[model samples]
Target chain A: MSLNPLHEIHTRRFSRNLGLGLTLGAFIAIIFGLTIVKVSRGDYEPPRAPTATEATQ
Target chain B: MSDVSINSPEFTGQGFEGEAQFGDFFALLKPRVMTLVVFTAAVGLLAAPVPVHPFVAFCAILFIAVGGGASGALNMWWDADIDAVMKRTARRPIPAGKVTGDEALAFGLTLSAFSVVFLGLASNWFAAGLLAFTIFFYVVIYTMWLKRWTPQNIVIGGAAGAFPPMIGWAVATGGISVESVLMFCLTFMWTPPHFWALALFIRKDYDHAGVPMLTVTHGRRSARNHILVYTLLLAVLAIATAFTSVGGPVYLVVALVLNALFVKGAYDIWRRDEDVSETDNFSVEKKFFKLSLLYLFAHFGAILIEAVLTRMGMGGWT
Candidate 1:
C-alpha cells in the first residue's frame, strides 16, 4: 500500500483550519477594498426622483 | 436439531452508510435561514435609491440565496461533531448520518466556489464580493472559531448573517451606503438577544456539546443579563432605523410597538430565577424564544412593506 504523508499533513494543517481563516480574511479585505473604490469614484448620482407612476394611489 | 438460525441479509449501498434522501440535500442548505436571507436581500434590492433591471434583480437574489445555502452546508459539515451531541441539532442531515462528512464538505466547497464565481459574473463585483465575504464569515469565523471559543460568539458572528441586505443594496447601486449599513446593524444588534434566549433554554445541550454558549459558560443569570442588554440595544437600533431613508410612518409604528413588546419580554426573562422558571406555569424562556422569531420577521416584513410603499410613492423619504 502507498502512503501519502504530504496529503495527510496538508489536510490536518491547512485544509481544516488555517486555510479557512486566511480565505475569509482575504474575502473581507476584497469587499472593503471594492467598497472603498466604488465610493471614491465621485459618482454620487442617486436614481432619478420618484416618478408620478410611483406616486399614484 | 430442530432449531434454525436466522440469517440477516447483507446490506449493500452505493454511497455513504445512511440513506440520503432528497430532503437531506435540501436540509443541508438550511432552507429556513435561506428564506430569511432571500427576503432581506429582496427588500434591499427594492429599497435601493437606484433601479435595477427586474431580471437582473431576480438573478442577484438567486445568487445570494445560493451563497447563503452554501454557507449553511459548510456550517453543518464543520459542526457535525457538536451537532451529534445536541438534541436540538442531532437530527440534522450530517449529524444524523444521512450524509457523510466528506460528501457535505465537498458539496459545500463546490457550492461556495460556484456561487461566488457565478454571482460575480452575473452582478457587479461589489455585490459578489459581499456574498463571498458573508459565506466565509459564516463558515470560517463564526462556525469554526468564535462559536466554540467565547460567549461573545453570537455578537461578532452576527455580522455574517446581517450582510444579505447590504449585499442586496449593492446589487442595485453597485456600491454601499449608510442606509444599507443601518439595515445590517438592525440584524447585527438583534442576533445576540435572539440566540441568547435560546441559549437560556438550551444550556444543557450546549454544555453537553462543550460549545461554550453564554448561558453555559457565564451562567444563566449572566446570559439573561446579556440578553436584556443586547435586546435594549437592538430596540434602539431598530427604532432608529425608522428615521433613515428606509423609514416612514408605517415602519415607525411597527418598530415602536415591536420594540416595546420585545423589551418587556426580555425584562421578564431577565427577572425570573431558574428555579422559579421551572415551577412557573408559563415558561418565560420559551415565550421569549418564540417572540424573538416573530420580532425578527416583523422587523424585516415592515422593511419590505416600507419599500413597497416607497416604490408606489405613497410614503417614504422623498
Candidate 2:
C-alpha cells in the first residue's frame, strides 16, 4: 500500500461517526416537525398573564 | 510542527501542521459534550409555556449547538496542556499533535463570534446573551481559572454546562422563569457527584496532572462523603421538580424510580472501603457513573414526554 498521510498517525472513524451525526439531525427534524404540527393545528396557545388568585399569595 | 507537509491540502501555512483530517476538526468541536447541550436545551425549549415557531426554534437550537461547540473548542485549546498529561486525554487533536493550539484557538473564537451573533439575530437577545456567558464561563472561569486553582473546580464550572436549558427557555419566552431556573439547578447540583464518581477511579490521573480535583485534594473517604451529601440534595431537587409546571405522572414516576436508584448508588459508594482489592476494581464507581448518565437523560426524557403529551392535550395533573 502507498503510504498515505491520512491513513497513518491519526485515527479515522468518519463513516460511523457521520452515521451517528445524521441520526442526530433526523432527531432534531422530528422535534421540529412536532412543533410545527402542534402550532399549525392551533393546539398550542400562548401563555396568559397570571390571574389575581395566581398572582397573590 | 513535525507533521506539516508543505503541499498538503490540510496545511494552510506557517501555523497549520500535520495532515489535519475531518475527524480532527470535528474532535475540536467536542461532539460528546455538544450532544448533552443539544438534548437538555431541547427539553428546556419544549417544556416552556410559550410556543415557538418551528423554523425559529430550529435556528435557536442550531445556534445554541454552535455556541456549545465553541465552548468545547475553547476548552480544549485552554486545557491542552493538562490534557496532554492525563492518560484519558493523551490522544486529543492538540496533544496528539494533529492540530496546533493556535489553530484550535482561532477555530474556537470564530465559532464563538459566529454562534453568538447569529443566535441574537435568530432568537431573542436574552438567549444569545446567555450563550455568550456560557462560553466565557467554560473557557475562562472553568478551564483557565478554576481547574488548577481549587478542588471545587467542577462545582463552580458546572454552571457553564447548566446554562443551555435556561438559554433554550429564553429562546421561547424571551425571559427567565421558575421552571428554567429549576432545570439549571438540577444540572448544576448533579455535576459534582457525577464527576467525582469518575474521579474515584481516575484519581491518580488528576494527581499526576496536578489538577486539584476533590479526589486529589481530599482523600477517597472525603470524596465519597461529598458524593453522598450531593446525591441526597440532588434527589430532593429532582423529586421536587416533578411537582412543578413541567411535571406530570410520567415525570413523577421516572423521578421517583431514578432518584431511588441514584441515592442507592451513592450510598453504596459511600460504604466502599478506601482501598481497592483485585476483585473490587472500582466497578461500583464506574457503574454509578454510567447510571448517572442515564439519570440525567431519563429526567430530561421524562420532561420531553410530558411536553409532548401536554401538546396533545392529554397531559398535566390529569
Candidate 3:
C-alpha cells in the first residue's frame, strides 16, 4: 500500500479551515466573557421582584 | 499522484484562486497598522480618569482593533489597483493575487458590522458610533475620495488613524473630553510629518501609482518644508499635552526630548537638497521616519506611565 504526498492546495485549505475555526471559537469566547462581565456588573439586571406593598398597590 | 498531471486544465484555469491561506486573508487586515491602533487605543483606555473592568476593557480593545482591521480590509479592496502599481504595496493580498477584491469586501463589511454592534453592547454606543464613523471615514472619505484626488490626502486621511485613542477614551468615559481630544490631536498632527518623511524617501512609488503624495505633487523641496512646518506644530501640541490630566512629569520629559529630536530631524531634512539627499541615499529622511515611530510610541508610553502613576497616587501635578 502507498500513500499520496500532501499537495500544496491541501495545506492552504487546512490552514484556512483551522484559522476560521479558531476565529469563530475566539469570537464565541469573547461574547461569553462579555456576557458574564455585563451580567455581573448589573448591566443586564432583571427588574426587581415586586415587594408586598407594591403588589398590594 | 501528481496533482498537476491529474487536472492540468482546471489547475491553470483556477490560477491563484482557492490558494489563499489564512495568513493571506489576515494580511488583508493590514495587521501592522492594526498593531498601532491596538497600542494607542489601549493607551487611551488606560490613561482615562475612569476605571474600566479589565475584561470589558479587553473586549473593547479587541472590538476596536477588529473595526480598525475591517477598515483596512476595505482599504485594500478599494485601493487594489493602486496598490498593484506601487512597489511598497504590490505584495498586499488583493494586489498580489492571493485574495480577490470581492472576498476582501465581504470580509471587511462583515467584520465592520460585527465589531460596531458588539462594541456598542460591550462598551457604549458612543464609542461604537465613533468606530463606525472611523471605518466610514477611512474607507469612504479617505480611501475612495481624498486619496486619489489631492496631495493633502495624507494630512486629512491621517484623521481616520487618529480616532482610535479617542474611541478608547470614549469606551471608559462614555463621552469625549479635553484629554481625549488631546490624544486625538497628538496622532492627527503626528501623521503628516511621519508620512511626509516616508514620502520623501519613497516618492517614486506614489508617482508611479498616481497617489498625489505631497512629495510627488509639490516637489521634494516643498515636501521637506511641509515636514518642518508640521513637525513644529506637532512638537507644540505634544509638549502642551504634558500639562494635561493625561500627562505628568514623566510625559513632560519624554515629550521635550522626543520633540527636540523630531524638530531637529525635520530641520535636517528641510535643509538638504536632492543632490545632498541622493549622495547619502536619503539617510536624514529615513532617520526622521524611524524617529517619528519612536516619537509617537514614547509620547503615548509616557502618557500610559503617567496614568499608572496617577493610579498609584503619585502622578499628576495636582
Candidate 4:
C-alpha cells in the first residue's frame, strides 16, 4: 500500500485520542468540582466595603 | 503521494494574489461561525448567576471571539489543499492565493498564542485554559486528525465549537457548573443536524474533495435518517433546557413552539425522495436547513432574555 502522508497523520495510533479524551474529561471534572466545593463552602460574604481613604476623599 | 517542501509559500492564481485585501483577512476568521460562537458565549456569560463587570465581560467576549478566529485561520492553513479542491471552500483566503498557506499558519499561530495568553491575564486561568484547549481541539484534533478520515468527523469535532459558552461561563464564575455543561450540550447536540442538512444538499462537494462526510460515505438516505434522529434529539434537549435555573416561562413557550416547527421540518426532509427533493422550488430540505439556524438562535435568545428578566427581578422560576 502506498503511504499517503495525510492519511498517515489522520490514521495515526489511537493512543493520542485516548490521552486527549481523558485529559478533557479530567479538565471538565476539576472545574465543575471546584465550583461545587466553593458554593457548598460559602458563608455568603458580600463585596468588601470601600476603604476609609475613599470615604475621606 | 509525493512530499512537498513547506519552506516556500504555495500560491495558486485562481485565488487572491499580489497583496492581501482587508476582506481577505476578515474571511480568514470564518465570520459566520464566529457570530454563532460569540452569541452563544454571550448567552453563557449572561446566564451565569454571578454578575461580571460590564467592561470585563466585553473584554472576555472579545478575546473569545479572537480565539475562535485564530482557530479558523489555523484550520484553513492546514486544510488548504483539500479546500482548494472543494467548491464550497475553494474561494477561502489560503486556497484562493489571497494569502499563502505559510502566511495563514503564521497569522493563526500568532493570534492563537496572543489570544490565549491575554485571555488568561484578562480573566481567570480556568477560562484561559479552556480557551487554549478549545483552540488546540479545533486545530490539532479536529482539523488535523478526524476531518478527512472519519465520517464521524462532525460528530466528534462538534465539541470544539461547543466550548465557547463553557469558557464564557468560566470567565464569569471562574469555574464550570451544571448550567454551563447544559449550555455546552445544547450546542454540541445541535451541530450534527445543522451540518448534516447541508451535507445532504452538498454531498457532491464532499465526494469531489474526497472528504468522508456522512452523506458521502454512508449515502444520502442514511445521512437523512441520521439528520432526523439528531434533530429529534436536539429538540428534546432544547425544551429540557427551559426548566433549568437560566430558563423560565418565556423560554419554555419559545422552545415548545420552535421545536415543534423544527421537528416537523426535519420530518419533511426525512420523507422526501432525493430526486423529487431536488426538483421543488421551496424544498423541505432547504427550509429545514434555514430553520435549523433560527432554532439555535431562538434558544440562545430566549436564554438571554430570561437572564435579563431574572436580573431585573421580574422572571425565572423562583
**Against the true two-chain complex, what DockQ does each candidate achieve?**
0.02, 0.06, 0.51, 0.02
Return the top candidate by lDDT: 3
Per-residue lDDT tens digits for candidate 2, residues B35-108, read: 99999999999999999877777778878998999889888898899899999999989999988899899989
Q: What's the TM-score of every candidate structure?
A: 0.80, 0.83, 0.94, 0.80
Candidate 1: residue pairs that collide: none
Chain A TM-score values, per prediction: 0.52, 0.53, 0.71, 0.53
* Displacement of the residue B11 alpha carbon in candidate 3, Å: 4.3
Model 4: per-residue lDDT, tens digit, B164-233?
A: 9899999999999988998898889888888888887776788888888998888888888988898889
Put down candidate 1 lDDT per residue, B177-285, tens digits, no spaces: 9989999998899888889888777667998999878888889889889989988998988988898888887889999998999999999988998888778743888
lDDT of every predicted structure (CA atoms): 0.82, 0.87, 0.92, 0.83
The per-prediction i-RMS, to one decimal, reads 13.5, 7.6, 5.4, 13.9
The fnat scores of all predictions, in order, read: 0.00, 0.00, 0.72, 0.00
TM-score of 4: 0.80
Clashing pairs in 4: B15-B96, B16-B96, B16-B97, B16-B98
B104-133 in candidate 3: lDDT tens per residue? 999999999999999999999999999999
Query: TM-score winner among the candidates?
Result: 3
Instruction: Give, for candidate 2 chain B, the lowest lDDT window spanning 10 residues.
Output: B6-15
Query: Between candidates 3 and 4, which one is better according to DockQ?
Result: 3
What is candidate 2's lDDT per residue for A1-57, written digit by digit as tens?
222456433343344367568857975785576567657866578878999999995
